[model samples]
Target: MRILIVHNLLWAHYKSSVFQALQHLVDQQADLSVQVLQIARNERSRAGLETSGGETPPTYTYNYELLFDRYLEETSVRERTRLLLQRARAYRPDVINLTGYYDPAQLLLLIWAKINGIKVVMQNESTAADQQRGGWKERFKRWIFSQCDGFFCFGSQAAKYVIQLGVPPAKVLLRKNAVDNNALRAVYERALPTRIQQQQALGLKPNNFVFVGRLIEAKNLPMLLTSFAEATKRSKNGDTWGIILLGEGDEQTKLIQTIHTLGLTEHVILLPGRPWFRVPEILALSNVLVLPSRSEPWGLVVNEAMACGLPVIVSERCGCAVDLVHHGQNGFVFDPDQATQLTQQLMQFMDSAVDMEQMGKAAKQFIAPYAPEVVAQEMLNGFIKITN
Candidate 1:
């Protein structure tokens, strides 16, 4: 079987990890082969996440062609459609896997593949709560979904969203997304011995709740600050804990002002953004990962933290919250609207009643099933099922 996968950004390290594992699988099976067409080098918003060498990270192990070595926004739809069609025709794949349906260029390719009797699979990450949905856009999504032969969704919420848009339940081929678990754990473990020294050098507290993402409005940073302040005030041992915001964004100035207003200047620390590979260093110094996003498709940082053996506190709106978080066991999930609930959960973490080490072990165990090799195998199985 020949599979052609179309992806948007070549700089996406997480997807590259899965593709690498998929290529390893293909190498072992004489009948199976895979190729990828990367639409662009990276997205404009993610340009800062590039390696210091200003080159793609040395993580790719799969066969892929980078069609445009520029930001995604710089490429016009006509150029993308023309090149994608030309490549698809040349490759003549038995099955085509598309990243998502939002891109008009990819959607055009999907229609072409269907016309040519090639099986098509869509990898989806959006959930019902991702954004407001209704009107002609919904109808268009339904039509596009109807053309797909199979799906590989990020998690349960994503799978349900596709099914709600008129896809048959059986067509939901794979229901997981993954990161490089072994690599993340290795990095975290390597940094473990020096974690205290690193934290002291940065003037960070002994125990910290770390938030690892862009500092944008959607992340609800101001709300997180308010909740963290309240949690600290309510917990007697909260003085030993602190909150670390580890990413750069437009809200930095405002978040700093909010920290001052909340009288948490001493308890809150803001760090500059780091590359994807270096995130485990910060995770090594943190006790828990907190993602209080008002809107999140899937919080991959949660997966990274879990792989590093740290429990997470995620909001219900995040797509991974349902599948990754086990409330009161590994971590807790709360409604973003309920600031008091988040405060309570934070205080619970700092209190002596909760066994953080045990919770961390549970988190590691819970996230093991979402490893890159496992997801790649499942994706190959989905292809076999659909093409058969």
Candidate 2:
């Protein structure tokens, strides 16, 4: 069986990990083959995340054909659709996997696959609760999902949204997200001994609540700062822990101003985001991960933090919070709208009321099931079921 996977970017390290694992599975099966058609090298939004050591290297080894030599954001939609159709026709895949319904070009491909009698599976990251949904877009999404033979979703919330849109439960396979756990953990463990030194070098406290993502409004950076300030003041130990924001965006300047306004200059640190491989190094220095997004689809950083054995404090709005975060167990989930609840959760960690080490262990254990190998096997199983 020949499978064609359509993805938007070759620079997506997380997707590359799954694709590599899928390739490993295919290598063991003589009858199965997989090929990916990537729209471009990277997106305009993440151009800074791309490293330039002469040229950016492939994050994972897999059989993929990049349709355009550069990133797709600058490419013409008409040309992109034409090229995508040309590749799909040339590949002649028995099954095709489209990334999501938001892309009109890929929607065209999905329609073509249906007309050609090819099995189609879709991978979705969005959740109905992530934003206000109702209108022509919702109607269009339902119609698109109807054409799919099956689905691979980001998490339970994402899966629930798809089922609500009329997809049968049996047709949905994956309901989780993961990173290169072993690979990330290996680097993190190697840097464990020097974690303190690393933190001290950055003028950070021994313990930190780290937020790693784009510094945009949706991340609720202002709320994080407010809660962190309140948590620090309320702490009996007197501002014992620090907060770190790692990533860049338009809100960086505003976030800095807010930190100053809160008189948290020494308490909060803002670092620019690094490439995927280097993120584990930063995670090693922090005691816990914090994602306070007002709206997040899956938040892959949560998975990366869990793999590194750092307990997370995720916003309840995030899809991954539904599955990965177990309140007061592996990590805590706080309502992004309520600063007081977040402050209280942060206080628990600051006071050392909870055994962080035990929670960290629980985090690692919980995240193990969401590894790339497991997800790849599930993907393969879902494909087999659909094709059979």
Please give the CA lDDT of all the candidate structures: 0.93, 0.90
Q: What is candidate 2's lDDT per residue for 61-130, written digit by digit as tens? A: 8899988878778777787789889988998999999988888888888889999999999999999878
Q: Taking the candidates one at a time, how many backbone clashes does each contain?
A: 0, 0
The weakest ten consecutive residues by lDDT in model 1 span: 51-60
Q: How far is candidate 1 from the true structure (C-alpha RMSD, Å)?
A: 1.3
Q: Which regions of candidate 2 fall more than 4 Å away from where they truly are?
A: 52-59
By TM-score, the best candidate is 1
| Clashing pairs for predicted structure model 1, backbone only | none
* Tens digits of lDDT, candidate 1, 98-211: 999989999999999999999999999999998998999999999999999999999999999999999999999998989898888988999999988998999999999999
My TM-score estimates for the predictions, one after another, are 0.98, 0.97
